[model samples]
Target: MAKKLIAESAAAPESFEQAMAELAQLVTQMEAGQLPLEASVAAYARGSELVRYCAAQLEKVESQVKVLEGDMLKPFAADGAGEGMQ
Candidate 1:
């Protein structure tokens, strides 16, 4: 079952959300501790792939945002106009 899932995961995730969802599902199943050693290994491998995929997706978006913002990334301020905001 785990190997089958890993094989299925080989077909790249359609989107970041999909990858995250799959990764979460894998974590839940592995945490159950019911899988055999081989299955666990397979799940770990697939999880790693999902993590990489998500990271790459985030990097791509970050680069685009940086370009759009002309690299003027500002530190986020929480309390709305907290001193020197203007």
Candidate 2:
């Protein structure tokens, strides 16, 4: 089973895509450096939250893959593969 990755995705757009989008926006804000110290701190906090969300999602998928293919998962690799190539 693929574990229905879509279930949580629809409920929380905050899945990987949304988290990465927010993280990118946060990076732009930090790079601009126009915000005040307090604002910067706030941005950093929000970014950290997104980081945690992304990490947790990755962990969940990792666990699912493990359950799906135990030892076989380790042998599968896509070291240089690009998106939409498959």
Candidate 3:
């Protein structure tokens, strides 16, 4: 039963936000030290999957942004214009 639950949770999240939320919840549960050893191990595995999913999503977005910018990704200028742009 526990294995089944863990396997179901291991499914990929619908989006990055969902993955992050699930990962945070898992961390909280693990930190509380309430789960049995087997459950804790399962949670750790699921957390790893979430982390990978989030990273892949971020990477995909970044690549898309780079292409949109003509593959010229530059440092962000909070002031809207850097000194050299003048």
Candidate that would win on TM-score: 1
User: For residues 1-86, could you state the per-residue lDDT of candidate 2 as single tens digits?
Assistant: 11122222223344698888867877787798776776677677777777888999999998898888863576434765565768
RMSD of each: 3.7, 11.2, 4.3
Question: Candidates sorted by TM-score, descending order?
Answer: 1, 3, 2
Model 3 clash pairs are: none
State model 2's lDDT. 0.67
* TM-scores, each model vs. reference: 0.82, 0.68, 0.80
Report the poorest 10 consecutive residues by lDDT, candidate 2: 1-10
TM-score of predicted model 2?
0.68
Q: Write the per-residue lDDT of candidate 1 for residues 7-70, one digit (tens) a residue.
A: 7787889999999999998999899998889989888988999999999999999999898889
lDDT of each: 0.88, 0.67, 0.85
Quick one: best lDDT, which candidate? 1
Residue 61 deviation, candidate 2, in Å? 0.3
Q: Is candidate 1 or candidate 3 better by TM-score?
A: 1
Q: What tens-digit string does per-residue lDDT give for candidate 3 at 2-64? A: 456567777779999989988988898889887889998999999998998999999999999
- Model 1 CA deviation exceeding 4 Å by range: 78-86
